[model samples]
Structure formats: structure tokens, C-alpha cells
Target: MNKTENSRRRGDELLESLYNATMKLATTTKLTNLTFQQIADEARTSRTVLYRRWSTPFDLLQDIYSYKAKKLFDGAFFDELKDNGSLRKDLLQLLTVYQKVHTEIGAEIINNYYFLRAQDKNDNNELLIHKQAVEKHLNATKKILANAEKRGEKIRKISPITLMLPYDLIRTENLIRPTNISKKRLTMMVDEILMPVFVG
Candidate 1:
């Protein structure tokens, strides 16, 4: 590789390492025990990189949350959302993936984020990151709904927020109770809310 290519590769490696370190710390340690120094040690890099980029752990975590949330929505989570000729099946699978994300990382990260944000309400950056992530998911959900509509389902007029009903409910369930959401509950969400919205 040329010099510039080498430099880019090195930068990417460092960033991946840092992000991995942050995620590891978030998952393994208590929220109160997180520090850039610890992350640096875990990542085998200098703490200055984190300090120069983010003013606080919350800021770094905002990036982490946004990145992971994007991956969750755009990555393998949506791979099976194509026209399967069954809206119920597609929705159930999608909800199951969303629930997996919540059970795996979303619950702890989001809970810690709210706790930290409550301690310092001036962090508009975190809020912006959060809003962007939510919007991304909303768009993805709309795409899925559009697919169902194209498949001859009579989807009703619904606002963006309303489109997020199933996802929001799963997120709330994760926050309230850190356990695997039952497939029955997911089916009920579809039968009770999603089906009505699409078929009503």
C-alpha cells in the first residue's frame, strides 16, 4: 500500500480497537467504573486518543451506541425482511432480532446512558446521536411496511412515531425487565397493534 493507504489502514485499525475496547468495558464493567485510562489499557493504546476526541465517556458512548444501533438496523437484522408473502412472519422475525439486540446490549447501554444523562442534562450531543439512531430505525421500519404494502397488504395511514410502536414496546420491555421477550408477547404485539395498523 502507498503511504496514504497505510495511514488510512492504521487509523481504521486504531478506531476499531478503541471501539471494541469501549464496548468491552461497557459490557464487562460497571457503568460507574468506566474510564478512558481503563479503555486505553484494554485497547493497548494511549488514552489521549479518547480524550482528544471525546470530552467524556458519555460522549464516546454516544458514538458507540449510534454505531451499534446503526449496525443493528442496517446489518443482519434486516436481511430477512424481504417479501416473504407473509407480513406476520416477517414482522415476527424482525421483532425477534430487535429483541435480541435489546437483550444483548441495548438494555444495559441505554439504561446507563439515561442514568448518566440524568446526572448531566446539558449533553445535547448524546441526545442528537440518539435521535439520529431512532430516525434510522424509523426509516427501516417504514421500508418494511412499504414492502408489506407492495405485497397487497392494506396498510393504513400512520405517522413515523406510530410506525415505531412494536420496536418502542420491545425497547420498553427490555428496560423494565432484562429477560428474553417471549415470542408470544411478540406475536401479541403484532396481532394487537401491527396487524390492526396494516390491515384496518
Candidate 2:
């Protein structure tokens, strides 16, 4: 490979390693206590590498969260979701995939980023990060509802808070139980909770 290509590959590898280390640390360590030194030690890199990029662990995590969240929504699953034939099926499939993605990204990491974001009331950039993530989720939910409308299903004009239900519900659920949230409970979320509010 050319020098430029080799340099790009090396940078990508370092980023992947850093992201992996941060996520792994998130499970056992609180974000409140996370440090550049810990991440460098875990990633087997120097603290200067982290310091050069992020002013704080929260900043680094924001990038990591954005990176991971993009991967979740960029999948073709949602594009084919409208054809699932029923609202309940669509919700179950949606939440199930969300659960899997959150599991893969580390539920603790998801929760920590959100919690820290929520606690920061003065930072415009932090608020922007949260808003951007929320918009992506809301757009996905709106598409599902819009598609259902095309299918002749009754779509309600719910509030923005309600539109955020799918993201919040599964995020909190997966964090609470980690890998232990049963498919049965997932079905109940679709049947007992989501269907009534979104459809009925």
C-alpha cells in the first residue's frame, strides 16, 4: 500500500482499539471515574494519544457514542422494516435489533453517555450531541409509523416525547438487565406498551 493509505489504516486501527478499550472499561468502571490514563493503559497506547484528541473522557466518549450509534442506524434492517406486515412485528423486530446493538456496544456505555449528557446542562456542544442522536432515533421511528400509515395502519399523531419511546425503553431495559431481558418481555413491550400508545 501507498504511504498515505498505510497512514490512514494505522489511524483507523488506533481509533478502533481506543473505542474498544473505552467500551470495555465502561462496563467495569464508572464514567464519572474514567481517566485518560486508564484508557491509555487499557488500550496499550500513550495518554498523549488520547489527550491530543479529547479534552476530557466525556468528549472522547461522545465521539465513540456517535460512531457506535451510526453503525446501529445505518443497517438495512430499518429499511425493510415497513414490510414486516404488522405494527407489532415491526416494533418487536426493531426493539430486538436495538437490544442486540446495545449489547454489542455495551449497555453500560450507552447508559453512561446518556447519563453524563443529561447531567451537563451548560454545554451547547453536549446538548447538540444528545439532540443529534435523538433526531436520528426519532427519524427512524417516524419512518416506521409513516410506512405503517401507507400500509393502512392507523398512525397516531403522538408527541415528540412519545416518539422517543423506543430508544429510551430498550436503552433503559437493556442497561437494567444487560443480556437477561427475555424475548417474552420484548414482546410485552411491543404488545402491552408500544402498540397501545403508538397504534391504539
Candidate 3:
């Protein structure tokens, strides 16, 4: 490849590395516990490079979440849903993946972000950006369900609030003490509680 092309690839790789480091820190430590120095060290890049790219830690976090969400949801999850061709099955799969990820790592970052945002009212931008990303994900999921409804398929009507409630509950329970809630149980809950309101 040309020098310019190689340079561009290198820059992209650097950004990816920085983002991965930030996400690792986010999942493993509280937001308040994270430092630019730590991120720089973890990414194998200098603080100057990170600062030039992101003005603040929040900006770095915003980019990290955007990258992680895209990596997690857009590719395999969406593809599997499209291929399944069964609305209920697809929704269940989506929820199952979400539940697993949230319980595993995503929930910690999400909670930490909220906790930090609460401590500083001036730090609304990071929280807003994170909230918007979440809303977009929910809207996309809703659109999928809407399409299924249009196809004459039966699905329970689900408000964004209702959809997120059980997820929050599961995350909280897991955080307190790991639970053995099966995917089947979650699927049943969605079918029984959410479907009734969403479908009719």
C-alpha cells in the first residue's frame, strides 16, 4: 500500500486500540476511578495523542461506547434476526443476547456512567450521548417488532420503558448476587408480560 494509505490504516488502528482500552477500563473500574494516564498506558499510546483525539475523558468514553455498541449489535445480532424470519424467535434471541451482555460487562459501564453523571450535573453531555445511543438501539428493536406486526405476525406491544424494565431488573439482581434465570424464563416473561401489551 502507499505511504498515505498505510498512515491512514495506522491511525485507524490506533483509534481502535484506544477505544478498546477505554472500554476495558470502563468495564473493570468505575468512571471516577479511570484516569487518562491509565488509558494511555493501557492503549500503549501517549496522553498527548489521546488528548488530541478527545478533549475529555467523557469524549473518549462516548467514542468507546459507540464503537462497542456497533461491534456488538449491528453485525451478528441483526444478521441473525433477519435470517431467523420468525419475529418472536428473533426478539427472544435479541433479548437473550442483551441480557447476557448487560449482566456480563455492559451493565457496569452503564451504571458507572450514570453514577458519574449524577455526581456532576454539568457532565450532561456524556450522559446525553449515552442515552441517545440507548434510545437508538431501542428504536431499532421496536422497528423490527413493528415490521413483524405488519407481516400479520402476533407480537405483544412493548413500550420502551417496559422492554427495559426487566433488563434493569436482571442486571440489578445479577449485580447483587448472580442468579440462574434461564433464557427460557426471560423469553416466557417477554411473551407473557410484554406481548400482551404490544401485540393487541
- List TM-scores for all candidates, in order: 0.66, 0.75, 0.58
lDDT of each: 0.71, 0.77, 0.63
Superposed on all Cα atoms, the candidates' RMSDs to the truth, in angstroms, are 5.8, 4.8, 6.2
Q: Could you tell me which residue pairs clash in candidate 3?
A: 156-195, 156-198, 156-199, 157-197, 157-198, 157-199
Which ranking of candidates, highest lDDT first?
2, 1, 3
Q: Pick the candidate with the highest TM-score.
A: 2
The residue pairs in collision within model 2 are none
Error of 3 at 170 (Å): 7.1
Mind giving the per-residue lDDT tens digits that candidate 1 earns over 60-178? 87776666565554455555556557678777777887887766666666676567767665765555545566676777678777888888887788888887876887877777766
Q: Per-residue alpha-carbon lDDT of model 2 for 70-136, expressed as tens digits?
A: 6554554455454588777888888987777777866666777678777678765563545566677
Weakest 10 consecutive residues of candidate 2 by summed lDDT: 1-10
| Residue-level lDDT tens digits of model 3 in 111-184 | 55455556667765553445555665666567667777778887665567765553455555455645556776
lDDT of 2 at 96: 85
Better of 1 and 2 by lDDT: 2
Which sections of candidate 1 miss by over 4 Å?
1-50, 67-70, 73-76, 104-106, 114-123, 127-135, 150-152
Model 2 Cα RMSD, 1 decimal? 4.8
Alpha carbon lDDT of residue 151, candidate 1?
A: 80
Output the better candidate (2/3) by TM-score.
Answer: 2
Ten residues in sequence with the least summed lDDT for candidate 3: 1-10
Of the candidates numbered 1 and 3, which has the greater TM-score value?
Answer: 1
The most accurate candidate by lDDT is 2
CA displacement after TM-score superposition, residue 177 of candidate 1 (Å): 2.3
